[model samples]
Target: MSAPFDLARQRFLTRCTVVSLPKPSPGAPPPSVVYYMHRDCRVQDNWAMVRASQLAREHSVPLKVFYPLFPSFGNMSSRQYSFQLAGLAAVEAELRELRVAFHLDHSSPPAAAVPAFAAAHGAIAVVTDHLPLRLLRSTNAAVAAELDALPGPVPLIQVDAANVVPVWEASGKREVGARTLRPKIGKLYGRFLTQFPPVPKMPAGSPLPPPTDWSAARAALKVAQVPDAPGLTAGTAAGMAHFRGFCETRLKKYAAVRNDPNEDAQSGMSPWVRFGQVGFQRLALDARKLGKHGEGVAAFIEEGVVRRELSDNFCFYNEEYDNLKGAAGWARESLELHNKDKREYTYTLAQFEKGETHDDLWNAAQLQLVGEGRMHGFMRMYWAKKILEWTESAEQALEWGLLLNDKYAMDGSCPNGYVGVAWSVMGTHDMGWKERDVFGKIRFMNYAGCKRKFQIEPFVSRYPPAAENCRKAGGEVALAPGVKAGKKKQKKA
Candidate 1:
């Protein structure tokens, strides 16, 4: 077995499991290496792209970057599509400068998209980043099979570029909680967290096919266009700008005011990170250099590094991660015992989507997701918990909550999103709390409990409740009687 450091580096080569598919045809002439850029979208500090460039350089062959555009995947909306399409423009330009080809495949089903193109181009190998979601995994398996049968055997490689510490390296099983996973990651992160050597610029080769028609790609997806999300922009440069500003201005106050919804102390990098516009390794290296502390820096690393990877671990290992079955056996049993418990109110999925709940605070959280494509990180817990309270059953609430969240949240549809909803409703990684009417042993979050932490009413006014639950002249929210909420949470899954 290789030493941990060497193995860690090899693990980082693609993003998830470093797969060398098609079994490498020996004695076969080297063909172009193609990189199917998926979840991670940035050009700099990207391991998958970096490794692909290296392989292409070693083989003395051309490198092709492909972005397969499925008309739509799952419940992702137009707003999400708009951000993804816009972010690729920068990725295209950067790859061109590096002498790599960038192609956006818009042909109906993405499963056939890349393999068909690679076969036509007589590609020898394909490299792409990782994602732990089941749907994406199925799509990848289908694509790999196609590549293997292509006129020639074509190899496909996958790298874990999204996580600072690859999920498998972090833990082999779904961790019980952040505490259990934190030390494991802390022990090894130092070795894997070193600087990412840049992808050395390649000589200007033949130009790539005409730049992908982003406008047409946008039209093809046909998703709803939510207002441009505040502070969250689409692209590597924008992501860096937002992250740099967060480290400079808000890093110090993050630990104190992060849970307060009205504060801007959050990193606001979800949309960027979700789309791979920014690399987590880049953020960590810079954070260390800044030397910020006081729970702010420590907590940020815990969430961004350990906790974030735990979410992927959950999805990668637990096939039932998105539903109640994914919860702990204790949690599932407790919820089942109370599935028919009477509730103060019950709302349908449509009602939940329209933010028509009786709770003003809940409605405000929903509106924030609807109008801006994001909800304050702390409020996400409150939002999901409320769904469980107001809906008919835990199963219904879980499904509706996932549906609403995946449809609106900019960071929705990844392992983080699935694990978050599971954690919120199913208590996947949490200890059993005091039993309650509906929640049973599940960790319950309510409006009063949130008030004990920070004033949540001002957040309601800021987003404006639905017509049924009108907001009065509620002014600024205060953390205490005289103090106002001063910081926002650093980041979310």
Candidate 2:
């Protein structure tokens, strides 16, 4: 007899492409199932959890959630670590309440840690979340291979639960830009945008395994490696509170002041979004319900939902997302033509990391990221473009930008970050502007240009200079030769 599957269950299963396993080796342990990848750390509105639960009920097997803590994954810093751990602590608490076992295993690579945990728990299959980043991709593949080679056949399921429209459903081919993807996303928006019903109530099952120790987890973290940032509170409760505050006050003016560095008009939800403390679907639905008739609501939704999801579509479909080699043909050609152009000033990776750039505005932007784990969305573009002008090559600029971004920005390690870097450094998903040196015809941003547009003094004043020497050597510093320094330092001491 086959297992009973409902309409909702069948609909979700059909969306995910399944990989068939080869026949098991004789005398091998039978496959035990579990979930291993992508921290979709929410209990409610998570397709991965829902699907995993359905399978568990059908098979009458114990289900568990496995998260591996790999410190060496990337340039993760103290700030990022604190934010992730805080959110996971909340998730662990939520999972305990749901009566599902949550396990945290420390290992160098998740592939090794996950399978071992599954085996210990007597899992028959493994369901993991799909992530577009190379590190996670390789980790998932490694785990799948390990399971394949096991003595018994273990089915591995990869779930696409991050985006509103699954990456495959959005587009099979890489989209050209927002314009191309916007319409395609719009046509199907109504279909997939519905709220995910709660994970179907299960009968009283075995109590969860021992909960992870939050205090020990904190003590064990390598604090020296992570960056320090302020104004960020971790966990789902805090995330929801922040979202509510944004919708109440900032959403009204988001359209008008989202670009202003000084105004807190933007939804400060990226940290939460990054860790899945709050799923994108929940936020989108709440925003839609709250701002049904207003332009502010519409604009915020466009950016938060439509545009942001489009980023996932880009990274998921394109392997070259991490490099300039993946840029549009015109952008690549233009950059190469200007490769020989003399740079006004060049800085090394160390100098850039230390915030030693000659441009005060640029340094201020960098300080914001280092100090707060974020910079204004508008400033991030200017931030990357300036790096292009001041570096030896576009490739070098990309490297520095991504390192600084992922290391400092709490919202780093996301498709949006990759897309932002590509758009600024290589002109992917963007159109060229008037020709300029170093940047060629690609879009350019300069300190003087920004100064002309806003109250530079106040914006600069927000972040004081990092170094005492830089502060003592006051007065506006010129980024290019022959330009005059202002009497007042761009930022206060």
Each prediction's RMSD to truth: 5.9, 5.2
Task: After the best TM-score superposition of candidate 2, give how far the Cα of residue 285 lies from its true spot, in angstroms.
Answer: 0.5
| Tens-digit per-residue lDDT, 1-493, candidate 2 | 2122222222222222342333456654443347674657777767777678777766766567888886644666777887887778777787777677788776346778876776566566788766677787777777767766654546577667777666677777888888888888788677767777566445565666677876766666664465556767888788899999988888888888788887888998888888777788778788888834388877877886677877887787887887877888889889988877899778888777767766666777888887778889988988899889989888888888888999899988788888999899999888988888888778888767776666565666566673322344343543333546556546421
Report the C-alpha lDDT of model 1 over 1-493, residue by residue, as the tens digit: 1112233433322223332333446664346778888899988888888778877777767788888987776678877877888899989998888878888878657678878777765576787788888777888888888876765566677778888878778888878988888888888887788777677677666557887887777777755555555555689998899888888899888988888887888888888888999988888888887865647887787778887888888888888888887889999999999898998778777777877755667777898898888988999999998888888899988888888888898888888888888888888888789988888889887666877776665666576554245223222222334555466522211
Indicate the residue-level lDDT of 284 in model 2.
79
Q: How many clashes does each candidate structure show, in the order listed?
A: 13, 10
- Per-residue lDDT, model 1, residue 19, is 28
The C-alpha TM-scores of every prediction are 0.89, 0.87
397: Cα error in model 1, Å: 0.9
Task: Count clashing residue pairs in model 1.
Answer: 13
> Candidate 1: where is the Cα deviation over 4 Å?
1-30, 222-231, 466-493
Q: CA lDDT of each candidate?
A: 0.77, 0.73
Scored by lDDT, model 2 comes in at 0.73
